[model samples]
Target: MRHARPLPTYLVQRYHGWKATAYHENKAWYRRLAKEGQHPRAMVISCCDSRVHVTSIFGADQGEFFIHRNIANLVPPHKPDGDLHGTSAALEYAVNVLKVAHIVVMGHSNCGGVKGCYDMCSGHAPELEEQASYVGRWMDLLRPGYERTAEIADPAERTRAMERQAVLVSLENLMTFPFVREAVEGEVMTLHGLWNDIGEGDLECYDPAKGDFVRV
Candidate 1:
């Protein structure tokens, strides 16, 4: 702990600025939130891309959303084995403890994780195939999505399709959890899939009936 670096000056300055402005303006609200534990109505599983501003995009206030970000917004099939399952743990707490009414898996355009899966599956990235590669192992979840979009000839289109596939895959995997399935079956909770076009600032939501993403 002694070797830990001090906070960067610019970040420290920004924090102070936020404290003076936003925090000062909403002191009562912030205090109320601190006194009362969070009771978020939704849980959002999104990519760890800095460009994907989950709260900003949804115009959410603090403590309104319970968010979990991973490589490609993936949710692995429910496995009860004793392992360090970070995403699964978050999901369990969100569904059972928080009792969130909705779980949203939001993928985004040009995700590095999705692209890496494409490269590895296409035989372009051999390094990722190694057993010790943490990223490679994590991205293995996206392999099925790549396979589903393999028939597309255009590289860009294929990647785009795969991005949407990631959302679909997570939605399907969420149901694999017994708690999630029970909540959904009893109409206590719902699942949603979303894709964000970062460049265009466009949002798309999955339409289960049409089996495609529709512009939002």
Candidate 2:
């Protein structure tokens, strides 16, 4: 707690502005939401990238979507060893408690985490290969994705493919959890994969039939 600092002046000013405007305008709605509690329709697992705004892309309002962001938006396969698993904990709550109807694993272009994984797996990033690197350990989750996309001749295209593979890998891993599998198999939940082109503002959704991402 001693390490924590007070809110920055600019952020405080921005918060005061929001409290004066948007919050004031929707005071009753906010109060109602507080009273009724949240019942989000979907759980969106997206990257920690600042450019990927899940709410803005879907035009969703407060409490409409449950969102969780991590590096590369990767989800490790189900492990019940009682270890610290933030993503799995979020998924458990979203599926069992919140009963979200859909789970979307969203990845984006120019993802630093994906790039790090690519570099590490390609033996180009020795620093990331160290045991002391937290980022390296986290990026290990995307090793499968890197392996899947390693053969592409074009570097740029290969990177993009790796990004999309992150989404695909997460979607696949989501099913590894028993709750997720039960929900999906019982027809109560659905899984989706998405890749966003940050520069062009284009969103592509994975099409099972086509075995590729189709622009939406």
Candidate 3:
């Protein structure tokens, strides 16, 4: 069976997504919804991967969960975004404007973005041409975790360790935003850290019980 050149998964998913929209009477739905208003209950910080879809995984509909997606599903501390911060902007909207009740930072297994972090840590990206201006420097944020786990000799175990640390770091970054801090302090919002193991088709929630992620 021949497939399209390069087989871009997003292209296929987009075609099917459009076809599935036949049942959606989307004629001016956004305009009508604008009149109705929106108040989503959850805000999901997720990866920009074609396979990791929070809406589908959570079985949510439009206006159900507001979403923010970026490379690695990362949350950087609230710095004056002199650059476009799609995730931070969306987070501000959800936590401040929409006042969502829950914020879920979802990291996933076998993530290429997380792999990039690993590759960088391995000292494999020595060429300056490999990064955009200051991106290489900013990527240093991940160094602490990688160095702490350097004693773990097994490659697979090291990767998993790094990925989990990324989730925890991102969860902590959420608190850097004042709105998020206020919401949590006022009991208006709760934070959750989740890991989606694509290989096992399982969702793991961070459990304080064992101080690690547990299937939920």
**What would the TM-scores of all predictions be?**
0.97, 0.97, 0.81
What local lDDT does model 3 show for residue 7? 52
Point to the candidate with the largest lDDT.
Answer: 1
Model 2, residue 203: distance off in Å is 0.4
Clashing pairs in 2: none
Would you list the rank order by lDDT, best first? 1, 2, 3
Q: How far off is residue 132 in model 1, in Å?
A: 0.8
For residues 1-216, could you state the per-residue lDDT of candidate 1 as single tens digits?
Answer: 789998999999999999999999999999999999899999999999999999999999999999999999999889889353999999999999999999999999999999888888899899999988888888888888988987899988898899999999889888999999999999999999999999999999999899899999
> Which numbered prediction scores highest in TM-score against the true structure?
1
lDDT of 1 at 62: 98
The total number of steric clashes, by the backbone 3 Å criterion, in model 3 comes to 0
Which residue pairs in candidate 1 collide? Answer: none
lDDT value, candidate 1, whole model: 0.93
lDDT tens digits by residue: candidate 3, 1-216: 475477589998887787678435574766666888988999888888889989888888778888888777778778875454666789888987898999998988987766667777787656422656354444455566678789999877887877777778888888888889998999989999999998788999998678899998
Worst 10 residues of 2 by lDDT: 75-84
Estimate candidate 3's alpha-carbon lDDT, on a 0 to 1 scale: 0.79
- Total clashing pairs in model 2: 0
